[model samples]
Target: MSSPSTLSPWRLSVAPMMDWTDRHCRYLHRLLTRHTLLYTEMVTTGALMHGSELRHLRFNAEEHPVALQLGGSEADELARAARMGERWGYDEINLNCGCPSERVQRGAFGACLMAEPQTVADGVKAMRDAVSIPVTVKHRIGIDKTESYEFVRDFVGTVADAGCEVFIVHARNAWLQGLSPKENREVPPLRYELAYRLKQDFPQLTVAVNGGITTNAQIAEHLRHVDGAMLGREAYHHPWLMTTWDETFFGDAPAQRSRDWVEDEMVRYMERAHAEDGCPWYAIARHMLGLRHGLRGARKWRQVWSDHRLKPLPPREVWAMAQAHVCNESDVLVA
Candidate 1:
C-alpha cells in the first residue's frame, strides 16, 4: 500500500466488468497496452470472506497497476476486503457503487448504495484506515429517476470528506427497479458534462468519466476535462484499440508486437495453460475472438479459431487454420 501520488496515473483504465475482465482477459489486455490500468471483475466481500479466496483474488504479475473492485456495503466488511486486496499486491482498491444488477442490489451494495452517501463514506473511511493503498469509489451520476446534479455532487463531497481521493463517475443513471443492467447502460443517456463539472467544482479531487466513450478521440476529449477515461465493453470487444493506447494516451513507446505476433504469443500461452494448468484452449480463445476485428477476412479467421472441432488439436493447429484462411482471402483479393 502506498500514497495516491505513488500510484500510476489513471489516465486510461478498463472498467471492472463481471464475467469479462477475468485474469486471463487482463493478461491479454496487458500484452497490448503497457500503461492502461486494468480492473478485476467486482468481487464481493461475502465471496472473498466465505468463498475460495485464491480463486477470487489471484492474478498474474504482468497485470501490474491493476485495481481490485469490491462490492459490499458494510464498513467493516469492505475494510477487511480492501486489506486483503492490498495483501494480494493490488495497486488500488475500488468500491463499486455503480452496478445496477439485481444480484448486486440483493447484496445491499452497488448503485443502491448511492442513496446512502454517508454509509458509502463510512465504508470509504474504514477501507482507507485499513489499507495503505489508494481507496477509490465508482458510482453513477444519479440513481433511479434523480437527475439533479446536486445529488452526485453531494455524494462526492461526503465521500471525499471520508478520505477517498479518486472518483470514477459513470456518466449515467442507474435505475434500480424495472431496468436490467444492460438497459441501464443503454437507456440512460450519457451526461459527460456532469463528470466534467465534478472536476471543475472539486479541483482537488481526481474525477474520471465512464460510459458511452468508444474511440480514442472521445478519450482525448474527456481527458481535457477529467483525470481519466475508463472503457468498458468497447475495450474488451475491440482489444486492438488498446494496442496503441500506451503511445497515444500515456506517451509510452509504441507497442512492438504486430497482430500476428500477439496471436502467436496467445497460442504459446494457451499451450502452456493446457500443459501445466489443464485449461482448455477454447476457454482462452474466446477472449481473443475480437482480435482480428475489422481486418480483411477477419470473420472467417475468427470462425476457424472458434471451431470446437479444433479443440482436440493443439493451439498451433488452430493458429495455422486461421492464418491459412486469411492468406486464402488475400490471394483471392489479389486476383
Candidate 2:
C-alpha cells in the first residue's frame, strides 16, 4: 500500500529465480510481505526485444517495488531493455550475472560474464545511462575454482564504477562446465565472508548476500555484515517465512494478515482471476501450496488444493475443502 520508493532498496529481497518468481508468484509474495523487494524471473534481452512486450513486461500494480532482471551481455541491447523496464514502471532494473545455466552461457551472458567484468560494466553503464531507476547487478562470487576474493572484489569495483550502487552477491562460485543449473546451486560452496568483505571494501555500495540464506535468524546475521539478504528456493518452498519479515527485519508492526486471512484473500484472488481473465485456478493455486508449510495438516491442505479433480469446482469450494484439513471441527461444521 505504501510507495516502493520510500522503502529501503537492499534491506531484504527475493531472488530472481528462472522458472519461479513469475508475476503470479510475486503477487503471492507481495501479499505476505509488503516491504521485501521482489524480482521478476530473468528475462533475456532477446526475449524482451523480440518477444511480446505485454506478455513479458505486464505485472500487477500490487507487485510494486519489483525489479526486472535482465540477462544479456550487449551494452546497447541491455540499455534498450532497461528503458522498457523503466517505462513499465519497475522500481529497479537488475542485470543477471549469477545464473549458471548452460543456456544462459550460450547466450554469452549470465555467470560467464563474470570473466568479462569490463563488458558487464559497459552494459551496466549503458543501462544506467538509459534509465533513471536504480540499476543493480546480481552475480556470483567467482567462476569455477577461482577462490581469490580479488576476482569478485574487482568485478564489484568495476561495476560500481559504472554507476551500479547495489550488488546482490550470490556467495558461491558458478561452475560453468561440469554442473547442471540445479547442481550449480547446490554443489558450489557458499563463502559468505567474501560478500561481507565486499561490503567492508566498498562501504559506499549497497551489498546484499544471497545463496544458502533460509531463515530470519540467518538474515539477521547477514545484515550485520552486508546491506541485505536475498532468499531464493527457501522463500518459494516455505513462503510463510516472508510473512514475518516486515516486522522482524524492517521493524514494522506485526503482519495484519493471519494465515487464515491470507488464505481467504488468495481465494478472492483466484475468484477474480477466473472471472476476469479465465485464468485457471491451478496456475495461481500452485504458488500458495507452500503457504501452510510446516503446519499441522499442511500436506493434506496442499493435496486438496492440488487435486486436479477439483478444477470443475469454484475456487471458493476448493478453498473450503482445503480449509477442512486445517480448520477445527467447529469451523468445518460451520462451513
Candidate 3:
C-alpha cells in the first residue's frame, strides 16, 4: 500500500454516486458509521476548473477521510484539479473510468477511457505527481464486448505501474455504445471472479470490488479474496446497513446512534443547510428517507416528508413529522 495512512483503514467504502451521493448523503453515511470511507459525487474537471468554489468543492470538514472523485482525461487539467483537492483537504483523488453515460462519452471520459488505458495511466501519473494524497482509480472490468479478463488484468498492471496503488473495480462490463447509464449499471452481467483474479494477480495493489454488493456476508466473502468492497445503491437505499461497518469491517468503535437519535442529528444538519445559501433542507432530507427502511411506519415516515405539501414546512418541522411517524408506529404496536 502506497502511504496506507493516506488510504482508508476501513477498506470498505461507498462508491462515488452521480447525483445520489452528494455532500448531504455523505454526511448522513458518516453519521451512521464512523469508519467507512466515503466519496464525493464525481465532479468533472471542467466544473472544478470554472465553477464557484463553494458549489464545486465546498464540503464540511466533518466529512473527512473522504475521497474526491474526478472525471477528466487531460493530464495537466487533472493534475491541477488534484492539487485543488489536496488544498481542500480531500484524502484521495480517484479517477473515474466506469461511468457509461452518453454525456461522459461525449467528453471523452468515463467508460470510453477504458479503451485508452495509456491516457488513464498518464492522468494517474500526473495527478499522483501533483498531489501528496493517494491517487486511485475506480473503473470497470471491460468496455462493450471486450470480455477478456486479461484486458482488465493488463489495465491494472499498466496503471499500477504508474504509482496508482488502489483500484476500485466495478465487477461488470460497460456496454458503452448501447446502454443508457442507468441500464449500464443494471443490464450488464457481473463477473466478480475476474475481480478476484485481478486481486490475486496484483497482490501489491489494494483491489476493492464494487457493483451490486449489499450485505455484510457478501462483503466478508469478497474481503477474503480482495482488499476491500465498495457499496453503491445498497448503501443509499438502506443506509442502516452501514451500522455494523465500524465493528464488522473497519474494527473501530461502533457509532452510538439510535434511529430517533439519527433523526435528531438531522435537525442540526438541517439548520446548517438553512444557514448556508443554495442548500435546500430536502436536498439533505431526501437521503434520509432510507434511514427508516424496514422499520415499522417507514411508509408514513417517507410519505410525510416526501409529500410536496410538506415542502413549505421548516426543516425542524419536517424532522418532527418523521419523529411523529416513528412514535405512532411504536404506539400502535404497543397497543
Candidate 4:
C-alpha cells in the first residue's frame, strides 16, 4: 500500500460532510475500499484551539489517507490548526471555502472566503509553511450568482501560487442568503464545465470535481475531464458503490468479500469501541445501515440494526438478530 503522498490520493474520495463522515463512518468506508481518500468533517480552527483535541482529531488507524478539513479564514489560526492536524498524523490539511450556511458566514469563513482570494492564498501559504504535509482547498465554482468562470479561475490561480497542489471544486454556486444549507445543495445549478476548464488552464495542478456526481459512470466521465471526482450524499446513502471503485478506478483486483463480512468486521469494531470508551453500538451501527443496499432482505436487515427497542442489547446480539434475516431463520427479533 503506497502512502497517499506516493500516489494520487484525490482520484476517488468521499466528501467531508458535516455530521456524517465521522470516525465511525470513515472506518466503515475504509473497510469497503482500501484506496479511496477519506475526509474528516469540517473542524473549525476554534474547535481545535479551544476544544478537546482528542474529540476533534481522533480517528481509527485504519482510515489512512484521510485529510483533515479546517474551516477558518485567519492565516495564523489556519496554520496552527494545520500543524495540529499534521502532528496528529493526518495525511493532508484541507481548507474549506465552499460551505454556505449562515452560521459559517457569521464566522467569516466558508464560501464567503471565495470573495477574498488573497486571504485564502495567505492562509494556504501559512499552512504550507507550517506543515510538511500537503495543503489543499475545497471551494465552489461561484458564490451567490457570480457565475463568471473568471471568478473561480482566479481563485484557483491565486491559491495555486501559494504552493497548494490539490483543489477540489464543487461545481455549484453557493447562495449565501435566503437559502438554507440543504436548499443550497439542491438549488445550485451544476457547472462541471468550469471545473474542467480549471484543469485545462492550470495544467500543473490536480483538480477534482464534486457536486451532483453519484454513479460510477459519472465518476468515470468526470475523470476524463478532471483529475478526480468526489461523492457526497450519494456515497453516504449507497456506499456499496465504493466496493467497486478500487477495481474500476485503480485497477485493483475485486475484493473477495460480502456485505456480511463487512458487517461482521464493523461488529468487531463496535464491540471494541464500546469496551474502550462505553461508546454505544447504535452509534457505530448507524453508519453501516446502507451496507446491504439494494440486496435482498436489506430492509429487514437495516430495520433490525436500527431498531430503537434493541438499544440495550449488545452489538453482537444485534448482529445476530440482523444476520438471522439473511440466513432465512424466522425466529429472530424484528423491528
Candidate 5:
C-alpha cells in the first residue's frame, strides 16, 4: 500500500485546544516529548486583525515544529493571519473546520465551514499562497447526519486540490444543531475507518486521526491505518503519556529524562516568564497539575499546585509544597 507514515512530523501531535493549549501549556508538553508536533489554540482571523498581535502569536523559541491554528472563513483575512503566523516563526498554518461551538459558528467558521467546502478551499489556497510554511486542515468526517462517505470524500478532494497536503480528521460527525461542543465530542461515534479511507484514496496526502484516542496503544493502532494520531484532553490531563513517545513511536533511544526533572525545568521557565512578562507563577503552574496524574498522591500534589492561596508564593516554593504531598504521605489528611 502506501509508504510507512512515521517519517512525517504530522505522525504524532497534540490537538489544538481552546484555552487549554496556550503557550505555557505547550512549553510543559514540549518538555515531555520533543518530536511530536504541538499546536497553538485556535486564534480567529479577526483577533489577529484587530487584537494584540504579540499576545496572540508570541511563542517560546523552544516550541519549534509548532503550528498556528486559525479560525475564519474569509480568504483575504485568512491569508493575512497566515502571513502573520509565518512572520512570527510558526512552522505550519492549520485551518480549523472541526470545531462545533456555537460561538465559532456565529463567527462563520469552524465545523460550519464543512458545509461550504469551496469557502474552506478558498481560505486554504489563500493561506498557502501567503506563506511558505505548510498549510493543513483539521476537520470532522461529516457534519450533522451527512454520514455518506461521499460527503467527506468530496470535501477532502476539493481542499486537496487547493494545496492542502495534510489533513487531521477528527473521525466523528459534528451535530451542529442539537449538541453543545462538549456533547459534540461525546455523543458522536468515532468512525476511524473514514479517516483510513481518506488516506487510502489520497495516498499522496498525509492524514492523521483525532478523537477519543486515550492511550499509546490506541495511537499505535490508528497509526497503522493513517499517517498519525492526535490526542486532545488525554494528552493535557496526563502529559506524562508523551514522555515515552520519542522512543516508542519515533524510534529514538530511550529518553534520559524523568518527571521530576521536567517539573524542575518548568520551575525555571516560570521564573523567566514571571520576570519578563509579569505573569503569575500560578498561571503557568495550573497547566502541570496533570503532570502527576495516576501516580501515588497525585490528587494531593495537584491540589497543592492548583491552590489559589499559593499565588503569593513563587513557583519553586509552590513546587516544594506539591512535592511534600508526593513525598510525605502524611499530607494526605487534606488536599
Candidate 6:
C-alpha cells in the first residue's frame, strides 16, 4: 500500500456532488471501493476561509485518498484553502469552475469562468504553488449554447500550461441562464466525444470524463481513451456498483462482505460520530439508505430507520434496527 498521495494518480474517482458527497456518504463509498479516490462536496472558499475550521474541514481517517473540492476565483483565498485542506489530510485539492448555479455566477465563478480561463489558470497555479499534493480542476465543455469542441480543448490547454496535470471534464454545456443547478446536471446534452478528443490533443494531461456515465462498463470503455472517469448521480443512486471498483480498478481481492456486514462497519462510524459533539447518527445514516438497494426488505429497512422512532434512539439502538435485516434470530437477540 502506497500512501494516498502516491496511489491517487493510478485510480478512478467519484465526483464531489453538492448535497450528496458529505462525510457520511464518503464513508459509505469507501466500503464499496477501497482504492478509487473520493471527493467532498464543493466547499466554498469563503466558508473554508471564514467559517469554523472544525466544521468545514473535519473528516474521518477512513476517507483517506479523498480530495477536497473548493469553489472560488481568488488566487490567494484558494491558495489559503488549499493549505488548510492539506493540513487536514486531504490527498488532493480541486478547483470547481464547472457548476452552473446562479449563486455561483453571482460570485463571479463557476461555468461562467470558462470564458475567463486566464483567471482560472491563476487560481490553479496559486493552489499548485501552495501545495505539493496534486492540485486539479473540473470544468464543463462549454456554457449556454456555445458548443464548439475547441472551446474545451482550449480550456484544457490553458489550464495545463498553468501546471494543472489532472482535468475532470464534465462533457456537457451549461446553460448558465435558464437551467437551474439540478437541471444543469441533467438537461445538458452529454458530449463524451469532445472529452475523448481532449485526451488526444493534450496527451500529457490526465483527462477524466464525467456526466451521464452510470455503469462500470461505461467507465471501463471511457478509460480506454481518457485517463479516468467520475460518477455523480449514478454513484449516489446505485451505490452498490462501487462494491466492485476495488477489485476491478485497483486489483484488490474482491470483498465478500454482504450488505449486512457493511452495515456493521457503520457502527464504528456511529460511535465516532456520537463522540464528536454537534454530529448526529441520522446525518450520516441518511446517505447509507441506498446501500442496500435491490436487497430483500431493503425498503423496510429504509422506512424503519427513517421513522421518527429511531431519531432519538442512541447509536446502539439505531445500529440494532439497521442490522435487523441481516442478523439471524440468535444474532439479533445477542446484539
Model 6 ranges off by over 4 Å: 1-10, 322-335
lDDT of 2: 0.90
Model 6: how far residue 81 lies from native, Å: 1.0
| Runs of candidate 3 exceeding 4 Å displacement | 1-10, 327-335
The C-alpha RMSD of each candidate to the native structure, in angstroms, is 3.4, 3.6, 3.0, 3.5, 3.1, 4.2
- lDDT per residue as tens, model 4, 122-184: 999999999999999999999997899999999999999999899999999999998999988
As a whole number from 0 to 100, the lDDT of residue 13 in candidate 5 is 96
What does candidate 3's lDDT look like per residue over 143-213, in tens digits? 99889999998898999888999999999999988788888888999999999999889888889999989
Model 1 residue 66 CA deviation (Å) reads 0.6
Model 5 quality (TM-score)? 0.95
- Superposed by TM-score, candidate 2 places the C-alpha of residue 334 at a distance from the truth, in angstroms, of 28
Q: How many backbone clashes does candidate 5 have?
A: 0
Q: Give the per-residue lDDT digits (tens) of candidate 2, residues 1-335.
A: 33444546778999998777888899899999988999999999999989999889989899988999999999999999999999999999999999998889889999999999999999999999999999999999999999999999999999889989999999999999999999999998999999999999999999999999888899989988998899999999989889898888777776777778888888898888788778888888898888877667787999999899999999899998998889442232211
When 3 and 4 are scored with TM-score, the better candidate is 4
Q: Which candidate, 1 or 5, would have the higher lDDT against the true structure?
A: 5
**Over the stretch 31-79, how does candidate 5's per-residue lDDT look in tens digits?**
9988889999999999999999999999999988799999999999999
Supply the global lDDT for candidate 1. Answer: 0.91
TM-score of each: 0.94, 0.94, 0.94, 0.95, 0.95, 0.93
lDDT of each: 0.91, 0.90, 0.87, 0.92, 0.92, 0.84
Model 4 lDDT-worst window of ten: 326-335
C-alpha positional error of residue 255 in candidate 4 after TM-score superposition, expressed in Å: 1.3
